[model samples]
Target: MASNISYKCPTCGAEIFWSAEKGCFDCIYCGDTFTLEQMKEAGAVVDQPIDEQKVEHAEEIVDGEYTQTTDGTVSKDLVKYSCSHCGAEIITDRSTAATICVYCGNAVIMSEQIIADFAPDYVIPFKVQKNKVMEAFKEFSKKPLTPKDFDCDKVVDKMQGVYIPFWLYSGKCDGRIEGEGINKKTYRRGDYEITEKRIHDIMRDGTVNFEMVPVDGSAKTEDAAMDSIEPYDFKDLVKFTPAYLSGFLAERFDEDADKCFPRAQERIENTTRSELEDSAAYDELDIKSYQKKTTIEKTEYAMLPTWLLYTTYKEEKFFFAMNGQTGKFIGNLPISKVKLVLYSLLGGIGGTVVGALLGMILG
Candidate 1:
């Protein structure tokens, strides 16, 4: 059975959401806040073990087209749950773990999906708030080449904080690099320049250990967009709790840890090779042969904080993302052809005037 969970203010029984600024859950209706410990003490949070049978059943159901329910027929791709706060129906796709009820405007966590095998092992709470993200987007859109008709405020309104699922990989790498080192010496003797070259074979072997290399586990997110806003501070990583997901959108991993490990392996191998090559001290090095072997020691599932916005300009879609923890923002803004032409003409005229003035002065 599908179940929905929502946190309520103890005083007024209104919906409460996690506040990034206060590091606690706040009730807008009652203006009261509660910490995770307080919520637990109040019997608001409880730990549930993974239900392996439910996980298998969910997998079977999603593999079909539709499912028959007591109310009506629902698509297997989407799951329907009733909002615990208002009894309104909440519809979500299979990947969605947390979302807001459209009718009642209450945060709903899909208890079954998250408590199954898809539960995260760790999570980084949001540090940057929506207002800060809006300010950052405003600054980002101020680039001179951006499209004139683009509306920053509209996109800001749609901005949402999400806990992106990631697979953290830890491993050790053993690698060896063989190359030729070249040295060149040039000297002037009696009005004649003499040059001498020396070349020598060099080899280096080393082992490198890496921890917490992240690869996004959701296929819906662009790989490049996720890669751009990286380097999350793992020190802030805490044990996963459903309370951290309140007031935000979250997705369960569609791509399992095994499927995402290859990317992490490649990154680890490339870094190991670079480290080995750097240890070979040489003026000019030409790598002739290289070999590497990587062994994955551990893998962990975690949810990292991110703010995402999607908009379309001239019928082309654009995406922007910010690191909720570090405030690192990245996106490709649309470049206006009209502005490019105007700037080019201005630059050409300015260059011509400067060249003429410099020519006269030198003459």
Candidate 2:
């Protein structure tokens, strides 16, 4: 991973940007001070995944389903950190540990609780590094209606590398669901009566082999914005490596895999149901009942990538997100009120003048 990514502060909730000039992290909150080296010493640990020791791995997993390895070689776990100064949390893949709080700007080492809660399955290296992210931010601020003093430069300092947690679920699907449907028809006779029929049918009995259904794992992420930056480049996913996480910041799932899995299952079921319904077509959809129950086996966890930013105008915050792998931009944008009013008023006055002139000419 490239060096110099963003991080969050623990004491206060401000997003802290990394500054090359400062060299050391400058916390805007609580005025705590620490360097990357100091934070690293406090917050770094790595444990390799050991498949042979299932019991040990199980013990390590504090909250969710333990990700077991059959290889006998245990996957290593790292000591992730949340900024004591700013309260921002992160997981690092590589050994170099110290980090500045992106929010409060204090130095922080990894915490044991953060390590356990945010353990992730894999990571996507920063292909579009922190600098690139800063560049993107600058471009974004240049758009119309952005604050007059909105110095993209200042945002750069606030830009920290964030590894938002996501759960990627994949497994064989055998779905079954039950729902009632009604079909009504009328006969155009003197004794005509509306005939209504209740229909039921089995939705699926066959297996559906699915891959990479993703669910958000971080409460910090906005649901709508996260969803908009979808369709990651799964092909670019590399084998799990902490080196990929070096110089950047990341989060392990606060939401456990088991809890998060339900969301994935829901998405898969919905997609599968739609597919089945499509096969039944509207004209041929003579149904009495619909039952679909999906059994998901052998689910695997992967981390999909996202680049996100939050901006505020007139106290109203706006979020923007990009698919880190695919570079698909998705988010809500606000129109400039001043510009809108200017145009509206100009059009109104111009129309009134023209109407009066035409009336006089016609008379």
Candidate 3:
């Protein structure tokens, strides 16, 4: 077992925790505060992932599952941290990430643990407060079609602030597009209406550049749910610092940056094709063929803030996510069937009334 890492107050010799509200690490005992730079000067190091793929001894294992030995000899790759509040032995696979203490209810930072390359180039700190998240969740539950028990403590208590891994990709897409379109001319000829139809070949070519396109690098998170809460304003992004992770959980990238390129490639190619189509004016357009080539310019790893709520319905898990920085919320929620039917019936009646009103006006 590895020794636990603690950030002691340089002035008081007491342990400290990161304060999200204050944007620094503070000692609960002596009331001393330290910034990331100050903490590094005080012997605190960056936290990094201990990938099972990279470590020959530490194999991947699910959470809550551990290896037990009779004689008590353990793998060199496994590390342990003890909670100061509860004294529970918190064991983590050499995956090198530490989260909240299950024994006590406080965030644990394994400072002495060896941090690695999964370290981010940038980080967006959490802007939304915990109370605000609970308030927003209450508002979200007010939707007419959601389950009635969404507000229960069993469902609402599990909300967490996690810094999710993202790979930023920037590239330029160059392409040529050739298609067919129709041009129409209509004019009045005395008492007769004259119409002319002309078909023309459309050819377009251009170079389109995309910057800071993000792809989630964590395998545990669903891609679509992560993407749904996007438009993370990059203006607030700052240099990656471990001080920002005081009360929150952050996961290291499980996959490489190059592995994320296919998604970015598809996104740029689709955008390039759309841009080409917008260049032509047509009454009717038919796209025949378009070919594009993509060149990736830059790739970097980073962490973004997210508020996640997990609940189980009929023994199956469900997740709701909100962008911690921008407050965009999305979830795969259970729908109320009675409410759905009622809403459908109301919509049908409303549509029919509007149709009757339009007919009366036109006739």
Off by over 4 Å in 1: 46-76, 348-363
Per-residue lDDT tens digits for candidate 3, residues 179-207, read: 89888899999998999999999899999
Residue range 134-239, candidate 1, lDDT tens digits: 9888887886667788888776787878889999998899999898988888999999999887999999899999998999998778777788788899998988
Residue pairs in clash, model 3: none
Give the best candidate by TM-score.
1
Clashes of each: 0, 56, 0
TM-score of each predicted structure versus truth? 0.85, 0.56, 0.75
Worst 10 residues of 1 by lDDT: 66-75
Report lDDT per candidate: 0.76, 0.49, 0.69
Of 1 and 2, the candidate ranking higher by TM-score: 1
lDDT of the structure predicted as candidate 3: 0.69
Stretches > 4 Å off in candidate 2: 1-118, 147-149, 175-205, 281-288, 344-363
